[model samples]
Target: MPRGFYTEGSLARLSREFDVFGPLSSDPEPWMTAELDQHAAAVCESITRDAGAVTLQNLSSYLQGFVDGCRERGWRSDSAGYDWETLRLLAVCRLAKEHGFVR
Candidate 1:
């Protein structure tokens, strides 16, 4: 599969499993919400140690997971409430392109 497609599929799978909705709704599916929260915490921890540790591979997986989680929960990217996942995904995409991971 193409890189973009692969990335998107990975993201979708993670999203479905995690049930991450956008920032709009406070209540997401219990299981996924908790898992996503944990993932976010891990990401934050990783960032504090070394920003460079956030490589293309790691960012790609993280962004995909966030996007998929949000999408599965029926959250809109444009919603005014919460879009941290969406924005994070965009940042990762840019980094991936800069690193030649995509295209």
Candidate 2:
């Protein structure tokens, strides 16, 4: 299995750090070395298709749009919180590299 692209960019590091240090901390170590999951991959595909292409130059904008959309509806319920925010960052980084957007 291939691992996701590991960019040394601030966005990538932010995701990993948030995942490891956030209140709902998760083990991103496995995600770092493992193949991208189907769900994330599928989301990435849809985003790429819908957005017409995501590159490092615009990744942050996409991230902002995601957060804005989430906030527009509801980012949290009783069961979940901001974990999806961090996960989306990680997922975007993963596919960004996979799609050669990170270079």
Q: Which prediction has the highest lDDT against the true structure? A: 2
For model 1, the superposed segments whose C-alpha errors exceed 4 Å read 1-7, 10-52, 76-85
Model 2 C-alpha RMSD vs. true structure (Å) is 8.4
Q: Per-residue lDDT of 1-103 in model 2, one digit per residue for the tens?
A: 1123232336556455444443224344554434336435656566678776666656666666765686677753222332454456556656555666543
For residues 3-102, what per-residue lDDT tens digits would candidate 1 score against the true structure?
1222245533423322233321245566545555565556656654655565656765567666678779885554443245543543344344445555
* RMSD to the hidden true structure, all candidates: 11.7, 8.4
In order, candidate lDDTs are 0.48, 0.51
By TM-score, the best candidate is: 2
